[model samples]
Target: MRIVSVRTWALAVFGIVASYASLYWVQANTVDGITPPLVGNLPSIVIQGIGVAVMVYVVAQLGLRQPIGRQWAWLTAGSASFWIGSIVWAYYEVVLEQPVPFPGLPDLFYLALYPLAAIGLFSAVSAFGKLFDTRVPLALAAAVSAVATGAVYFAVFRTIAADAQLSAIEKIISFFYPLGDIWLLLFPAAALALTAGQLRGGRLAWPWWIVVLGYLMVAAADVMFTVGTWDDTYQSGSIIDTGWWLGFSAVAVAASLMLDVQRPRDTGEVAS
Candidate 1:
């Protein structure tokens, strides 16, 4: 128990330090060609990788404390998928000595995260039993998803599809990135509905909200990446790269917060 706590603190500290270092590096250096310096790539990869691993560990610990069934499995799997995908991306940057390919093997793993995380969050919420009504939340999720999809189509898909430089496959894969985000946002919106304007069980919703926030950051980050790519202005180690780490850090914190969940005893036992 003490060891876990210590390790968690250490990882948290590392995340903080890496974040500052990354920002400082970006601010201190002028644009060095298109690729970021190793300083930027290494810290972002190492810190975020460790952070996500820690979050997975925390989720696993929570499962051991209570009967979470496969809820933890889905969340951890989703987190792990992204972490693995990041590693593959790093391999291209670090080991292969090449630019990371767009819509390459990494996309398979990255895209998988959307479905996996959506299921994981849904399972986590449902595991609370029927304590909270979900009708409004469900509707809200659909509405938000619709709006986001429309915005993404107009802002991202139309441009990518119309680009004369991209082949059909490239355009199709580019579209998938934002499309996946639209789907991913629904899980958190539903969670927001369950937690909004309530106090009793709303505490449980914090982790969900945190994950939602993380995904939101991710969505924003990806948008910047896409726009940069489209305009031929994307830099590998630019400030935009910080978004991925920060987002994952939020996810790590969310996973850690779940450690305190009492695991609802029964629907009636929980306060309304």
Candidate 2:
């Protein structure tokens, strides 16, 4: 018991350190023309990479200690894709001394995160049974996505890309942000639906809530970044970055808590 308690404490401290360190590094290294050493992109790399590692560790070491399941595997892969995108962006920002290209490797990884994460969340909810059936909840999720996406497009994207000088590629890239945000917003909605009537709740409920919050935070951070980029006012170390730090940290926390949560059913069990 003491050993487990100490290990949990260690994870908490590590998470706090990693989250704040990324924020501090971003703030310190955002100069336009001046280039820092490897430190320039180190913060982004470390934050995302550590986030991936922590999520996997939590799912593997703490999450039931059974063989790593498809749900956790998908989530881990999603984080890894984001980390890879971060590294690619860092290379573009630091080594090349240029902006990351539109529709590039970074974008590929970033885009991949959505479907993978969605699948993972879907799988997680499916474990709780018919709470998230295909008909009502999915229709509701789609309706929510449509409304939210429409509002965001009108309010944010329209204003940002209204310039005549913007090209086809630019418009596409600008659209990607909102699309991704909308897709991510589905997780929490599904999670809420899944746990709606259950009073006592499964062991997995807390972790699911944490993951849901993390996804929502990611969407919120993306929104801020989109708006900030449109206005040309987003800064590297700004408070906007906190969304990601907190979001990823929440995910890590979920992973760590997985062991204490109820074990997820196998794929076959969930499908039935």
Candidate 3:
């Protein structure tokens, strides 16, 4: 770790502790007179606020100095977008004290995160070196996984399109979130592919996988929300919320560790 990383790490630790404590309180305290909004939903806003701020600090502290910097910039944008989504969602739950609508303003921001993150990730990794070495079959597996993810997206979309209760716009918007998240999983599924084989997986090297873990957390929550809500069975403050909280925390922590992550470029083999 770089000596300058102390502050960044401090902020990341705060986010983690805050999120964990908030989540622990929500889940462990089961008692009388407990509403889901107060006990389950409100804390998310607090977590998102801290999580996004930590990431913003990380990006701002580092600035856009290198390819990794550019990648983190986009990642920060992704986290900020999710933070906005959480705020909009909380406005409905905490401020208005009503059921948040599906396919609302929050959904728009939430859907944008995947593309922003994907573009940054692909751009940086591809610039570092060959993202997928044709010499290895892993690239082929990445291809297959991408295809499968796309197939699942279309299948789910078709089902949504057939639903009579939803409007035409709702049909498309409703599926976009889970669709984007399912795409998120593709990153970790082909983790080695993203390591940019040309650098001997040294471009992002270590923290990139942690970032992928963040994607996986959010993506797993996407699966939980999609399936659980199909029958209107999803509950607030459930284990699903932990995925998002932890996901955001992971991103902040990952960005803070960029100092060590970028060290490989100085001495080890690096692509120009």
Question: What TM-score quantifies how close candidate 2 is to the native fold?
Answer: 0.76
CA lDDT of every candidate: 0.66, 0.63, 0.66
Off by over 4 Å in 2: 1-13, 28-40, 59-68, 130-147, 196-202, 231-238, 263-272
Q: How far out, in Å, is residue 256 in model 1?
A: 0.4
lDDT of 1 by residue, 74-147 (tens): 66677678778877877887778787777688888877877887776666556543655766676677788789
Q: List the residue pairs that clash in candidate 2.
A: 62-259
Model 1 misplacement above 4 A:
1-17, 27-31, 34-37, 64-69, 186-189, 192-201, 263-272
lDDT, candidate 2, at 123? 64
lDDT of 3 by residue, 118-163 (tens): 7776666456445444334345546655775677667555665676
Ranking by TM-score: 1, 3, 2
Top-TM-score candidate index: 1
- What's the CA error at residue 14 for candidate 3, in Å? 5.0
Ranking by lDDT: 3, 1, 2
- Give lDDT for model 3: 0.66
Reference-based TM-score, model 3: 0.76
Error of 2 at 13 (Å): 4.6
